[model samples]
Target: MRSGGLMGTAALALLAAPAWAQSASSGDGDSFLGGEWQPVDPAELEQMRGGFEMPSGLNVSFGIERAVYVNGDLVANTVLNIPDIAAITPEQAAQVADFNRGRVVQIGEGNVVMPAQMAGALVVQNTLDNQTITTLTRIDVAVDSVATLQAINFSNLISDALAGSVSP
Candidate 1:
């Protein structure tokens, strides 16, 4: 048979296959494939945060204040401190702002998962090599109700995993 005919036959065979044969199934009649969801412990969460490493020459620092399971979702509050925002070049500042502007930021070195954004807050959830880190930036506002600075929240999942991977 010609290559085109062979391809068509294969496609027909796949189309004819029953749905049950294509889907995941356990022998015990349960359709679900995985076990029940369990909350991650504090120690393990810390380990994940340790995995995240900021790029070198970024000239910024961050700290994870807290991590808690809210409605089965991990919520981490982090503070990213920019001591000398003026010291950083405009390009570097733009890079940081752009990092929070996307749903997923890929800097060619690592993946930054930003799921949502709101007034003065950026929600980051990153999972690399089976380690998951979710963070929520805690924003600080000035006396005039104007937002001034923002922090990057790191869960143990990111910090521990990225430990030694980032340099000052």
Candidate 2:
């Protein structure tokens, strides 16, 4: 009879486990990463462009995410999703980095640079008044090598800063 009671208690505890987990996982609605994402407006994109000039013959898009959360608390208010460069061959990507060597600039709390092969893409982030403005420019210039692209002043466009701010 004692063993039967113990078995019943164990089964009850097992049933309650999922409930506990569900409640814990639910968290506060505001604490979820998915809940923080909101659509970015076109004007916002223009503002983020700041003084940077876009190189001709390249495609650009902007996306914004609300602050990041960790353990149900706000960690980062904004995250700039890096542009996709999956279409570029690894060798070409390396050349892009080499072409922009020594052009990486750091201003305030942010950085601007053409990152290396694995890093991929050109990025510029500048923080003003506690907000971070990030821009990732993916240039699409068909050429045999980075040198050929450099001939057309491609490095100038890849070497500019983006503007925006994220509040805490």
Candidate 3:
């Protein structure tokens, strides 16, 4: 009878464990890596004119959690994943890292930092010129003037900053 009771207690404990575990987890599964890597919709697909085309075999297990636009063009996209970051290549990892380091998008008067995992494949459009700048780059991260720099980071990155705050 003791053994049966112990088994019953164990079963009850197992059932209760998941409830607590779910609270700590991003149960929404909205991540930029390994989550869902689906392709851009037909309406959104028209924007990728001068960048690496989304691979045909690109697997997307989850929907995009966020979409970023610049100059009315789709610039950055993010999702979630369940697997390890190692699933992507080192070069890809580097690109992702580069994309994320200082990715700050200047929308209107505000500076928004893009998430790291979705950094590599950002597609930003210049609000002024309406140009679709493919790829977030280190150069792009640089603020234009001292005022913009002041708006984002007041570091001395202005004179030595890259062309943009994004990396491919």
Candidate 4:
């Protein structure tokens, strides 16, 4: 009633062979996976710099320039500009719009504080007792976004935040 071990082992070995073979150091033309270890050339990677082909799925391009898009969830992002919430800065808006035009660079991080945090800090709390130990930590990125219409005065923002001039 329970004899599927060989199939499981074979499947696992097949999946793991690529990773194990890649790292095996063999000078005698031998591999731990019973195959020759082949080195991947850097030029090959460069040659396939653009989009990759999937056996099945959508065909996309490695487009990194401004373009008019349709029916796509496009978000404008940058490292040099921040949106002015008080009022939209024409220049910053244009930069974000232009940056989105490229349509290749994807924004991985979002949810920025009003004034970006200069120092990446984590808040941690730890408590211990004879019976139990409790630890809590929160990680957050405190950095400004790239697309700022104008320059930011960090000192002023910090001073104002500290003085309760502005509520975070």
**Best model per lDDT:** 2
Clashes of 2: 5
Question: In candidate 3, what are the lDDT values of residues 1-168, reduced to their tens digit?
Answer: 576455445445545556654663445664344465554574443222112211332222211234555546865554322222436556545544554553444444333455555544443324454444444222101111323323323233342255346544
Better of 1 and 4 by lDDT: 1
Please list the Cα RMSD from the true structure of every candidate, rounded to 1 decimal place.
23.9, 24.0, 22.9, 24.4
lDDT of 4 by residue, 115-157 (tens): 2332222222223223222222222111122112012223334
For model 2, what is the alpha-carbon lDDT of residue 145? 30
Stretches of candidate 1 exceeding 4 Å from the true structure: 1-70, 75-79, 89-95, 102-137, 140-168
Once fitted onto the true fold, the runs of candidate 3 whose alpha carbons sit more than 4 angstroms away are: 1-66, 70-72, 77-88, 107-168
What is the model-wide C-alpha lDDT for candidate 1?
A: 0.38
lDDT (C-alpha) at residue 91 in model 1 = 54
Best by TM-score: 3
Single out the weakest 10-residue window by summed lDDT for candidate 4. Answer: 141-150
Clashes of 4: 11
Assess the local accuracy of residue 128 in candidate 3 as a C-alpha lDDT between 0 and 100: 50
- Residue 117 in candidate 3 has what lDDT? 50
Question: Candidate 1, residue 32: CA error in Å?
Answer: 47
lDDT of 2 by residue, 11-33 (tens): 45545656764764576654334
Candidate 1 vs candidate 4: which has greater TM-score? 1
